[model samples]
Target chain A: MSLAAFLTPESHSTCRPVGASVLGQRLESPADIADITRRVWQDSMNVLQAPHIYSGVEMALWDLLGKRYEEPVYRLLGYDKAFAKQPYVVVPFAAVPEQTFERMRHIRQAGYRAVKTGWSGFGHGNIASDLSQLAAAREGLGADARLFIDAARIWGCDVVAAKRYCPLFDQFSIEWVEEPFDPTALNAYADFAAHHGRMRLAAGENIHSIQQAQQLLNIAGIGVIQIDCGRVGGIGAAKEIAQYADLRCARYINHTYTSHLALSASLQAYAGLERQDLCEYPMDPTSLSWSICREHLLVGGDGEVTIPNAPGLGITISLDDLQRYVVDLEIRIGRTTLYRTPSIR
Target chain B: MSLAAFLTPESHSTCRPVGASVLGQRLESPADIADITRRVWQDSMNVLQAPHIYSGVEMALWDLLGKRYEEPVYRLLGYDKAFAKQPYVVVPFAAVPEQTFERMRHIRQAGYRAVKTGWSGFGHGNIASDLSQLAAAREGLGADARLFIDAARIWGCDVVAAKRYCPLFDQFSIEWVEEPFDPTALNAYADFAAHHGRMRLAAGENIHSIQQAQQLLNIAGIGVIQIDCGRVGGIGAAKEIAQYADLRCARYINHTYTSHLALSASLQAYAGLERQDLCEYPMDPTSLSWSICREHLLVGGDGEVTIPNAPGLGITISLDDLQRYVVDLEIRIGRTTLYRTPSIR
Candidate 1:
């Protein structure tokens, strides 16, 4: 796993943006094979087919792979040698395990260092009925809160007993156990990511492409490369699948689902492949957290998320902020829109 | 294409929840998979990585193959011999090509039929790059406005004259020319769908599965098959992908984008395959045409739509009729239902 050459001469550099994924929006847009087969068979016979989701052509191929790589999509894929900033948790199940462990001890004592667990109705049965509601909210939040578990597996249930419920995900300290199955169960979570590589497992965000993340990292391979960085094609296509999943030694995370201009464009695709991993913060205030980023979501007060040192994910748009969410998402105002298409002529 | 007879009728009958996509709130029904993966990663990651877009997980596998074949998802598949009724075209695009061709020649002189056109942009490019605005809206709408040209694609531009711009889509007679391009140019539209399959040469609605309709029916292969029927997972997953694209012969259309309860769940999955096809009807009023159901999309006076015999997309929701678009998305709702480390049985 080596390839990090250097020694160049700089001019006016800095290129970050391909943060959306699942095959870079059918590869930077090329329709008209008779109008993309008449809107792909009129949306396969009339709308309602978002099975897994993420669209704007993987956010314009993660803004054309962060302006074709000058670097930032998680340090061109190394998750920044692991740890620049990653801490999430907003489980919200309409309350009750002592109010979800006092909102995970006030989002980890207001630093939101990390959190997630809210699958209600996958309830009434196993994970010991969601381990007695997080063991009665960890006996009512005694120490700090840092946990994770996401069973959604495309809304279908009975997660094949997530490995005899791995001692109930090692008694709720579950830092991994996501997507309980779907995306072809990646060889049954690669035999549950080789018997819990120290409890880390996590799944790919409903994988869209990079050959379905090289077929779920050649089945059952993920010690923690959750990636999503905005559904796989936006911090320049998650810095080309976090630089080809940082040549396999795996470990990256960015799945923050939109606003904070997609969380500083997924902290600039994990500010170069992961600083510490964890960015799923919706801070739960609703109309779907205010129709998600209808204003480009930006929370602070040291719960973290500084990163936005500028260039792209410092996000700058004011066509009345694109006419307040989808006024037909148009842009073209000025700044001589540099290079044009046909794969950069 | 003859794998029918397989009933094995025993005893299976418990299908209720008539209509629901819900998520309106209580912390947005507990942030359903992070608010449906952040309100569908911008058009679900460009309609699931385009290869002429066919993400058909069998339209939710035919809502589970017409509730395991009680039959309705296009009569379980065979699309009920392709057309008893599915004509839709509601594209007003923000109107004005002489009031959108006099409302598409008054919905084809009020019999209420097939129609789709209304994508302009003008200011700099597209109305199919202006041949005097597609010959003054085809000499001010006479041809029953069967137009269908809309230009919702241009991926910012530099499209190196996509097939020398097909003489203004052959002067707006255009019965098909929807997204124009963006799911990574499926081999430059399979070389323009093998240089135009007899002109009407259509497309799917930015497809999302069935291996992207079997790789655009094994390259440039399309006559028409458009499927979407609710994010490819609802009307039992587009009738298990129109029975696996009817052994690659291909045919289906439904992508009209929501509420006629998802076009009456795409007319019971095209009433079991092929209804000749045209079910889109989106004409516009708003809020999915006035708060989702009771009725507003309107096209009657005989213009088509009939379909609602009542059962699955036949509609029935009442939490006091969705308690005025519900709410509780949570700015704060903690009593800490914490499930800290445990040993439940």
Candidate 2:
């Protein structure tokens, strides 16, 4: 679902928030957005899993609001200035230990001081394989660099299974272990956090509401709250969580894996928080993700990136790329066309 | 989304669980259900809000499983026998106090011992109107009958607003005040539960997962835990919560306002718990809802309802009604057809 919120066509300040999931209901006009969002909130039993449609619509609304006010989204969100963040190169674990080492080495060579390797059978394999991968990642990053391991919820609720890798994580000096258990497995998270040595639990990328994030911080004992703006009901919700995390004395970070547009939206939430400096940057994005924005927030000499100072989300959406990648779609109920993809002007 | 799960077409035990929300993705075969459910869990930030699709799918799977085993769903769920539940007539508040009185009187005359009036501007109006309605309902039902007030979440975290009617609730001997605040407003629920009078807090119909139901029982201080199997990831999740509620000594009830098919599915969760007897029976269902099931679970002279002893959900789906109501739906991407409404044979 690609939503462009605008006051008028002549204003020419269209805001696009591309939602990956399709909405269950049809929106006749912009007036329906709030009502639909409220219905979604009231009807959905789990706000965290059902907030994608509302999230995208909310992001677009914020973008439009920013453009109307002629200020950056961060400024509109009450931040006087956007803070610079240390960009961590995010990649998946390679097929083998040597490949994982090479990937980490390449990231280090590319001036990224922090790197995260996740998914791709990381925790699913044998203990020896995991140890080799961890050893390779640490050796390749060369000691001083920050290394984050994302287990991607491989262990579910099994504390014993997750604890097996804790010694290896401690040996590798991992900054944090991300999503070792399911998000709703509060007991498991708390238990794991209590037993783990040195490494802190980091999660909340899947959080859609403020309450879930607070639960993770308060009950799950996570040291880091990673929020994705596009997934967490847009910037407003993410900002709320960031503020809550600050109140609870926890680190807040943005989780971005898609376009630079998403990256900017994610950053605007906690862009003013200088202390929570790390930002997850997609180092090897798919072509579709890369095509969404014309200009990217590139890493600088200091190995840090800042959100654009210009108005709205401060990134221009590439119409040409969107058109090239656009799939012509239509949804028909009986004889009536409920939805048809609008032509890119 | 209507799903029919079966091991084989020749088995003649097609189980249908009609989902209120459309699925975001297309399922190629039965094998995709588990994978899609997992994706929905992982990708959705709010599982409670996003589990509708999975819930319906899950119900269908359980129905099929029960049919294969030649036993009632409750028995398959590990219950030795299904217990009879006290049926309560569920209706919206009338337009005026007199109408409310008449409605309650009518329900009483029809032999229902318990009645619940909710929504339709119940708590939205001034305190005087609420009191008048409450008085009228109580007087019409007489002194012996149980009265449940469904606030329909009109207060929205306003403890003061909800508290204004507490004295009236106690005076009328109201059994429970349902959803006085927003489902996610844990603080408000806890606050209101702490200060409220005789009427206990009842909630959990909006719960989509076991964790959420448990949270309400353990943290929110709700005495009555209502589970809608059609919404809370099907019978499995509802049964889990019922057991959890039993362990915590919370009153477990079904929140059904749809077809008899849904009512049966809802009943199956807590059908084994004899002590938790109240079952919500839709007294004012829409025509479409009424037409969905061939056989209805009518309240007996004993003022109680029981699940069918037959295999599966027991109630036969009205194919004629489904065909009559089925809207022709088609989704197309480019030249390829992703989905079209399956013909009801």
For all candidates in order, the CA lDDT equals 0.46, 0.74
Best by lDDT: 2
The per-residue C-alpha lDDT of model 1 at residue A105 equals 67
**Per-residue accuracy of model 1 over B11-76 as CA lDDT, tens digit each:** 111111111111232221212322433333322322332111112222333343344434444443
True contacts kept of 1: 0.00
Chain B TM-scores across candidates: 0.30, 0.86
Per-residue CA lDDT of candidate 1, range A1-345, in tens? Answer: 000001011111111111111212243222211232233222321221121122333343344444555443333334443243545755644345667667666665666556667566443345555676777655444445566777655322234455666676677676676766554445566666777762376667756444456546554576665656544434444555655666675655666644456666655654654434456665554434234444443446654555654333435444443434431111111333221221211
- TM-scores of the candidates in the order shown: 0.32, 0.87
Error of 1 at A93 (Å): 20
Residue A113, candidate 2: C-alpha displacement in angstroms: 1.1
Tell me the interface RMSD of every candidate, in Å.
20.3, 7.8
Error of 2 at A69 (Å): 2.2
In angstroms, the error of model 1 at B102 is 21
lDDT tens digits, residue span B1-345, model 2: 112111101111111212322245454433444555555455442322345656766777767767877788888777899888889888667889999899889989989889888677777757788788888888889999989988877787789989888888889998889999877677688889889831299988776667778778766778888888877777778888998888878899888877888888899888888888789988644567778788888877777897899888888888998788897877676887756888997
Measured with C-alpha atoms, the lDDT of residue B221 in candidate 2 is 79
